[model samples]
Target: MYAGCFLVLSLISFTIQTETAVYIQHRMGWNKAYCMLYFTHGSWSLLWPMQLLILRLQKWNVPWQPFWRRHVAILRSTAQMIQHRTLHLTPRQSQQSPLRYMIWTTAYVTCALTVAGGSWYVAVDMTTASDLTAIYNCSAFFAYVFSIPLLHEKVRFGKVLAVAVAIAGVLVVAYGGKAEESTPKHGGKSGGGAGGPDHDAKEPQNRALGNIVIGIGSVLYGFYEVLYKKVACPPDGCSPGRGMLFANTFGSMIGFFTLCVLWIPLPILHFTGLEKFELPTGDTAKMLLVSVLANATFSGSFLILISLTSPVLSSVAALLTIFIVALVDVMLPGDLATPLSGNAIAGGCLIIAAFIMLSVATYREMDEERRQKEMEVAESEVDEDEA
Candidate 1:
């Protein structure tokens, strides 16, 4: 239930974020991609605080000191689980500080995320939007591949087939439509925080190069997702609330790193005039705020979803956004709406079908794991009695 809610939240916010990014760059003429990325990522820092407020409100009857202490302990214990990648810990391990490990992990993980995300901007001008969409979304396939070794996920035929179908759907949506004459290109901001393509940009100077770069980015993005699952997510059998809390806490750590370390590039970019620093005002500022908040919401929900489910599932679920975005475009007023192609209808159905198959498979996997654990527990109790 929580997983479904998070998925919906992520899909909605991601669509809104994508559209606002386009508006901010094209309509408002604020083309600072890095700045937008910085602000949105930094907003993650608010998650923990917001969570704390909600938690406190829930326990309003409790004494302040006790509530605060309990909150600190919960965070510390969850941090330990993340650092060690398990819920069980030895006395020595529990006593040792998880702070250093967490800080280092958060730093490197955020670095990976930034690079993977930045690739969108770097390649957007160098490739067709069709290529960008198709290639980047291929991260869903890579996520499943990486999960085999990194996550110890068994190579099940059902999962492989589902992933294949999902990718096919994406291809259909991207390339199945009949070709039309290319529109005249305009000089505008080429990428946004999420690294979306600037469709209005000139033709690619080097299609081959852009494809290769974005391809690397796609692999890296998948690796990042699996890595987070391995390093940050709580071990199996953890309660949903605990998983959600820790997910937001870890998200805040990412946000904190972005604010403290990633800001260094802003100055360098400004000095080099690669992207001069300029603040948004008027409607631009209003819309930018909305976009940033929406992104924060999406990021938080996405993290929680990954913690609750497998990265492969989360990545495949994200593909739903492509169809949703198309639907949104169709709803836009005047010239903004892109006509819904037959390919989109066909592709969207395939993607949905794939998601249903994968979801059933995942549920069965979880049930089997649960029963196996129960058996192990029963066997352990028998052995203790015999002793």
Candidate 2:
């Protein structure tokens, strides 16, 4: 039940993020509000909400332990029980393997760092929120690539080809959307005009940069997904939930550090004697507040969704974001519409098709496993009864 809710919430969060990004671009002209919001509020708001959810589970009697503890307990007990029934084994045989733990811990930390750093970098570099959101939609490509080797999972050749087709589609969408240049408008001298009042607004340059940064970030994020699945639980005895909790906690910490470092360079580079930092206007503050809340919801739900579903599913659901954003854009007056080209439509369909194939494969695998388990139990029962 929780998993189902998490998946639904995750889908909703992506949709909301798309809508919010569009709103920010339409209202704030991409430069002033979008970049700042991504740097400051994006990770911070997400941390607390997710933390609260994890803590709530604990309060409701969920057992939480470090990866080592739970796995060691299982290995120790299994070895002891086996030894009692047969020949006694050496102390080393009874103990949990340290090398395996070390390898997994390293992978987890590396994944966390990559994801946190990439997220921060993209947020800092991306000029427009829509481009950032769109780039993230391509994360499924990375997820599929990493899943095979990292998670020891096999995908069908058809599904692989479908994913490739989806990538082609994404390329089409990225190339089709062209940005236009506009002059930056300044509102009197009440607030700081750090870039100067007449700083020419180069929308095309910013959009292109934003798209590139976001696309790279999505790839890095996909690698993180594989790391999480592999190290999240060990057969020797770690709980997947506990591993996820630690990784997320550590990832959030890294995000905070990255945010601070990114912001440090920006403040120092402010134009001299143009306009110093001032309190935000009433409307700006209100907008920031709403964005923060929406961002938090999106972030918290995303983590929960990832925990509940595979990275591929999460990635597929994210593809829906573009459609949601399109709806929002059409409803709003004076918003620019990038005409749907043949490539864009084809890419969208390919992505959707890939997701369907992946889902069918997953379901088939699960059913087969369940049947095998049942057969094993039935065979054991028959042998016992005959004896």
Candidate 3:
């Protein structure tokens, strides 16, 4: 039941976030990751509070009065912990709103999306949009590796095989899925070149570099995801509703850092002629406004999935976005559409098969766990009657 709910929600959220961001960068003329990061991070700030307030109305534990105060304290403590390399949680603190949990959320926002999101948008400039998304999702295998030790999810053959399958699929999509329309030969008179951003990004070398950077971002994001499961949404007593509220609130806080740190570097980079850091204006700003809203909901929904399901499931679920985004890019009336390739189709199939395999393995574990609990309950009843 939990898995089903999570799967559906994850699919929607991942699709919305990936497709919107790619569309803005790849299709529309707005490709500033710095601007995108501010909006993306701010989206959480926009969303989590409203959801928390809703929970409060429903009688869930929503800290109202001093919550913002504690939020500030958490930020300061996290900064201190970073500087001193000293952070610990007491047993009681472990159960409540701990600085560790908030810290991890900030780390995820900065490391995963802020960093990864930036790389991903830049990647869009170089590679085909679909290919960029597909390759970046190769993070599933990275998450799988970290899950074993961090999540204590047992290493099983089926799960391992699934990871291998998905990785192969992503590679196939990245390299051989060469859309007929992707190269000049496939260019249509409709003026939809599919590599629409800047003409220079269409270079083969730039595509290669984009792929490398996106892949690196994926690895780091995978780490962020597994740690989120293990640290933020522990299986002991946390619920999706509760974790969503806290995780997202902490995530929103990262926007503050982005506002501060990313701001300073923009002028430095601009003045030094390193990279152009232009603020969004007009249509670019409008697109960012809409995209960030999607991002906020995306973060909220993603955390809910992680809390209800495993990190591996959440990661694998994102693979579906590649197919969905690719289809949209191809079908939509725009130059951003890369021609759909046979290899990409094959890759998508392989990835879907991998998802099924992982699902089956997870179900088997759940069955065994259910049986063990039932047996324990029965034995306890027997002892009670015997007494």
lDDT of each residue in 25-125, candidate 3, tens digit only? 65566655554555566556656467556656765464666665665565444433333324554444434544554555565546555565556545655
Off by over 4 Å in 3: 1-6, 26-28, 56-109, 119-135, 179-213, 260-262, 334-339, 377-387
RMSD of each: 3.1, 9.0, 6.7
Best by lDDT: 1
Instruction: Summarize candidate 1's per-residue lDDT along 39-125 as a digit string, tens digits.
Output: 988888989999999998999999999999988888888888777767888798789898998888898889888887777777766
Once superposed on the true structure, which residue ranges of model 2 sit more than 4 Å away at CA? Answer: 1-4, 29-138, 176-218, 232-281, 334-347, 379-387
lDDT of residue 317 for candidate 2: 54
lDDT of model number 2: 0.48
Give the TM-score ranking, best first: 1, 3, 2
Q: List the residue pairs that clash in candidate 3.
A: none
Q: Relative to the unseen true structure, what is the C-alpha lDDT of residue 237 in candidate 1, on a scale of 0 to 100?
A: 71
Give the winner by TM-score.
Answer: 1
RMSD to native, candidate 1: 3.1
Global lDDT of each model? Answer: 0.81, 0.48, 0.60
Estimate, for each residue in 138-177, the C-alpha lDDT of model 2 and write its tens digit. 5677788888887666777755675665555555444444
Q: Which ten residues in a row have the lowest lDDT in candidate 2?
A: 185-194
